[model samples]
Target: MRAPEREYDSDPASHAHSQTRTLSSSPPPKTNGYVANGHGSPINGSSKHLKSPVARVELPGSTIYDDSYIDREEYIRLVIQSLRDIGYIESAATLEAESGYVMETSRVAEFRRCILDGTWSEAEGALGHLGVGEDDGLWEAKFLISQQKYLEYLEMGKITMALHVLRNELAPLHMDPELLHPLSSLIMCTDSADLRQKAGWDGAHGSSRRRLLVNLQSYIPSSLMIPPRRFVTLLDQARLHQISHCIYHNAPVTPQHFSLYADHTCDTDLFPRITTTILQVHTDEVWSLEWSHNGKFLASASKDKSVIVWSVGPNSNPDIYVHLHLQDHQFPVGCLAWSLDDTILLSSCEQLIKMWNTESGALIRTIEAHTEPVSALAWVPDGSGFISASQDRKINLWGSDGKQRDSWGITATRIIDLAVTPDYTRLVAIGESAKDPILPPPRSDATAASGANRNGNNNTATSSPRTLEYLMIVYDLTTKQPELSVSLGGQLTSVKISSDSQYALVNHAPDEIHLWDLFTGRLARKYTGQRQGRHIIRSCFGGVDGNFVVSGSEDGNVYVWHRDRAILLDVLTGHGSGSVNSVAWNPRNTQMFASCSDDCTIRLWEPSAGDRDGDSSTRLAHRTADDRSHEGEPNVKGKGRSRESWVEDDSASRSL
Candidate 1:
């Protein structure tokens, strides 16, 4: 049975009186599971004309189409409700009178009167008639009625009567001690005022009985009492079902935007595909990129040994310019992270982590704590400190001032990447463990024959192959203790947590991205089709509700997939030759995303504009080998190849 909706009786006295008057005109006669007729006349088993209520009633010249599947009675009830919803009381009453279908039965109307009129014994006896079976709901409803009666008895200064009801009536119901103890304690009140204050309920003359009636309605069946706003609920549910099935739905659904005439669906052109701007500030390969928390700026770490911060233009403008160029890193900048407030940015390279003031572009502090290259940085949700993972098998906590607050001991595996959940409850990390025995790399048959001949002539020592086992460990942020560990057998490059912190997207090498449900410690889905064997390609959760997965490929293209279906939606090609290394979706604008590449540029993408007559692919500037040879120049010095040359090379791949 469908559970009824929740709605309270607003004007209890008037509503009960109105229902009483309507049903009293022609009281329905009791029959054996048979529906009453238009004149409130019950049909017996011998009557062949009238069947059960579930059977369709034949109506002459009905407005509804005969071929339609809608039930005649249900349609009339919905019409009545729709009329009432728009404050048409007279119209609704007339429709009910003409349709000969009361919203509730005659028995239910009597029960409503008994509940509102403070007739406790009569109301309690009517519960079974209202279809409340002899179950927990029936007893629970009876307890509420008896409790209200006890409170009213005390309000009338009848202390002895309240005690008798508590001991004899409520105690025999076998309810929980927690509920019975409260009623027992209420007996100690000094007077009516004290009783009312302690019980937290008004007297019987107040709205207490009306509230009781509303609660008891849930115990009865919807056939006896219709749920409030049932028609509106059904329509809203149907609209949501349509939206859920739409693969490209990224925007919120509203009555102003959606129509009831057709099924809901969003156009694919709304996805971020067109490249509106190209940022060519970095002369070397851009390795990592991240948008600021407020989405006003974008930060990129590059192989040029520099970290550049770019300011995003306003919504009306479609341009990005270099905001700050920090050229202090000795090695290639590997990763970047932003504070929760977007005031601080951290860039990692080799064994050093640098904190910079985002607005002033001044270097705040530099800390060298890890022996190996710092692999990832994640800020604490509160902005008090940050956590950094390194390839040296260690995880360190540092304050915003670059002070080491705490450090976990060396782990068994080398930590590669880590992220702090948005809720600040858990910290997850991807570590590589080499506990298994090493096996040599497979050699070709001819190479093995040549090696054997060389070994027979002169014995030469060969190097053993390296082995690795990836493990994802989850730690309680408060206790800083490992809570759950899952073994994912793959070469993991990076990890990104969802906004709700319930799932994590882990980039797996050799062509797969695994979506893991963190709570279940299981891989929920695998997204494929992007080339990711050697280079460290990054992916992120995008779209308005994070229903899309956007990733970069070593094949110099950006891949977008539906997160729930694992369907490859688009392969965006813009970078000239080098691999697209990282992708970042704007936190503020759902229609925009950014992708950086080894082509030494950052491309900003937005939904396709209809007025733009060109193809979906963005035009890229042609570049000679000499033009890209320089490692650390802030800007390109020479004229690259023509736009036509790069367009012929970067072929756009649509949904597969």
Candidate 2:
């Protein structure tokens, strides 16, 4: 016998109060002799009422309740519907009974059961009863159902019935001829295996029926069954749309953020892999390399007295090749720089700087301003001009027309390297500082006078030391005046400023690199473990937020270290017979980086495919542990905050 349908009160507040009253230890309140119903209606025609039950509703920590947006009953209905749509039938039934919500009607359950039982006539009637419209979706669903029934008849060796079903049912649906032709051919098969081979159906009763039901749900309106994965699919589309429009999205969107509705299965298998491309056109040592701002091309200068422009393909595959080669420089090219617009290329040879048109490889301008070998070159932020430092103890600013605009001389010491901030507000130059003359001891005035008279008339004499001290000077670009000067012990080979201009990466001779805080002029951290004595090994700041420092080594390997913690991360090797001269990371594509070496080849490095399967959190934890292991012994002495103390201590230790 059919059970009577249960009735529920629509008043959520009264229902909740009744549940809550059961949990509390309080006496019933009454005004008259009669009690009141849970809905605030007086019973027995009296104005008095007993207390209602109180409900203990435990909300999630992150939930904020708003009755105006959604009422208690509506929220519970949504939950129940979601549970049933995802195939959690048992849970949905339990929730429906407890919450007094009926999400799935008897007709919907009957339709599902008919499909699973292979009762084609009942399923069709059920679909029609569910209000499926006479649209293309309806016809397409009917065709699939007819085709499945035809296959079932053939599988049971009833050839005559299979032909009758196909010719009458499937043909009347007006499906495309391509689909109809395949269904008509299924009747010629003798056995289930033959039918499965001809028509790509598995001939499985349960799985095939389940798939047909899923397909039919797509045709039926969501008001009937709430199309499977409807909430999840809509949420995914919204997230992708937002990510595509976001201005600051650096990585792909993942299912780790807050969402109203989401599927918990997230594929976190995104990582780059290395290709097999190695540029071997240069016949001599490659001294320096730089990427275009747009990351379309790579310019490499070598000791072969040539600069080769490699065209970087969009796919970043193993097909990058040389685009242009400029061989105008008579001496070996030492440094390279691209203009802000990436149209002009600058290559520095000893005492000369040549400008070439990047597109045509034509020599546009040549400036011969330095008296000695030019050691460093930096373009102004606006690309209006450039600055060149040389061993002649001079620094000159030149325009694009090859004319010197300004020139300044240091205190008789060769300039080693220079770097300008991204904003062009400050310029830092590293060079040797002038030394004070050594005077004879004051204890021998007579001996000093006798020696002076023997040399000249009667003047005291002094001698100067052979070696000068190395120092770094910061200059105000607007005023062209020295701002701060600090002494350094070892010779500085290369200098790079962070993108934010907060710190400077300075490479010292032999093997050490120091990170200096620009605002305070204090040493922030130090990186080691690279052999840098023989060549000018250039290092750069990379990673998503410039969290890593990548540099070349004389040991024929590329070394990477954490910028803040100074922990060595990777030591990549493949440079055949010489030291790695420079490493350049793609400004746009952070996954790929290139390293050029004295072996006259450029090698590309990327993450292995195996790394993609590893969890991102695990990789980060490993990196942090490595940093801790390397943090025990400080490379720089004294945790000094003052500039003087830090520099002086570092200089003294290096001198020892």
Candidate 3:
């Protein structure tokens, strides 16, 4: 027998009493004339109380709410049109029926179907029915349709019919001679392959047919078909423009709320080109260069014992001119550093360190910093003091007041180079360990008889053998204790710490730059392909996120390598016949960087305006060559035209 359905009272008090009575196994509570059914429908009949208990169904916590901000009909219509445009035919049809909004008119649908199926007459009739008269756009659309029909006939081996369609349908339309001539010449094609090759068309099928339909849609009015998302497209373009102009814009703009979708565009031309403006004022080999934090001034030191600071103007007028020439150093300035405030410049020459006010070009202070030549200098993170390393086997910390605050010595070694971490937590030093002293051989008796020896012992001391053990040591600045000491093979020339202080780039002799993990003390990577013999070539890390390492090469080129993969990206030439001493990337600009060479010039590198203006063929060839060169092995020098030749070519073209 079927169980009687249970009903409940509509009043809350009566329902509570009924549940209480059922749970206590007492008689059921009497209900009013009206009772509530399972779906909350009122039933006007006697209640059929259940003899057994019933389980109550709990509703989900989430509730459905109506959106009143946007017009529901317009939004649904747009969604349906988008679905149809993207080929969700069944969903679009169902949505159109349910929403009672027609996304596409019958005439537009017929026109699209005819275009896709190569029914030229039907498609042309539909265009006429939609009021696409013999205007310029309609003519072009008709020409494309007629041309597709001709190609379809040719593919089916209907030569006579194909010729007929071309002469009767296509030739009548006043199209460009360049296009019409090509279509007319396809009549001589005997087979489908010949037509495909000669005409450069895939013969009116698949993507080609779909392309025709899209073209036809463009000529049709929005009232005949579905309108495009013009507002959304414009918003997307504005977002992209803002990002391209603002250097600090790192986050991508995505659709939110009312803006359902948008094409997020970014300027991907991040790498600088080879063509650059060469700053040619320095008289001798440029040794070191640095970009100030604000990117307004570039300070460069040269072997002529002079430092020239160049002021680069704003983008509206990007004129570069010499701002100051500091000639105080008696010897060649080998290194340069700018204070955190960009008001002071520190230059190193031999054992002397000079601090100069950048604006007045006055020497602020001079300190005989070391007993031996100072190899490296770095300012502390807070800019309160600085540190310098010397060949005297010592690392000295000095305050801004020109007083030595603390001094620490590395045992049995002369410091060759040093780099301090950005956080001021540690210091890395590279040097050669000192060897034990050796005594000279005893002098002969004849020399003693001739009284040639000044000493009575008649013996001289000889130099010990050259030390081959190169040491790389890390020290804790807070505790002033040795953290890591490892032996390396070749002589250390230069060292640099990453901005994040996570890795250190150390240049070892004969042509190698090692990337060492600071935390684990493991060799993370090695960048090669640069000539490095006796020259002190410096390597640094820079890029959008410090993903690339750039170094000066003795071969008169700058080599760039990817940090993660250690792959050589480019070997930029044109620094003349001398070694590129230093390469400094602008801290504020990714597209602009500077390279100083022994040729006595600093070249400012940026994206070439001509590159973006080149012809399509030229740009394609350039991009292809770049891609192939960076794929497998590093490109050898002399494989392409030298930068000198490229510059000369550019000059010749400009003359024309």
Predicted structure 2, TM vs. truth: 0.51
Work out the TM-score per prediction: 0.68, 0.51, 0.52
C-alpha lDDT values of all predictions: 0.70, 0.64, 0.64
Report the alpha-carbon TM-score of model 3 versus the true structure: 0.52
Model 1 per-residue lDDT tens digits across residues 135-198: 7399999999999988988888888998899989999999999999988888788987888888
Instruction: Show pairs that collide, candidate 2.
Output: 17-53, 18-53, 19-54, 19-55, 20-53, 20-54, 20-55, 21-53, 21-54
lDDT (Cα, tens digit) per residue for candidate 3, span 580-626: 87888777766667888888778776555433334323533443221
Q: What's model 3's lDDT at 217?
A: 66
lDDT comparing candidate 3 with the true structure? 0.64
Q: How many residue pairs of model 2 clash at the backbone?
A: 9
Q: What is the lDDT of residue 113 in candidate 1?
A: 65
Better of 1 and 3 by TM-score: 1
Off by over 4 Å in 2: 1-275, 411-413, 434-465, 609-656
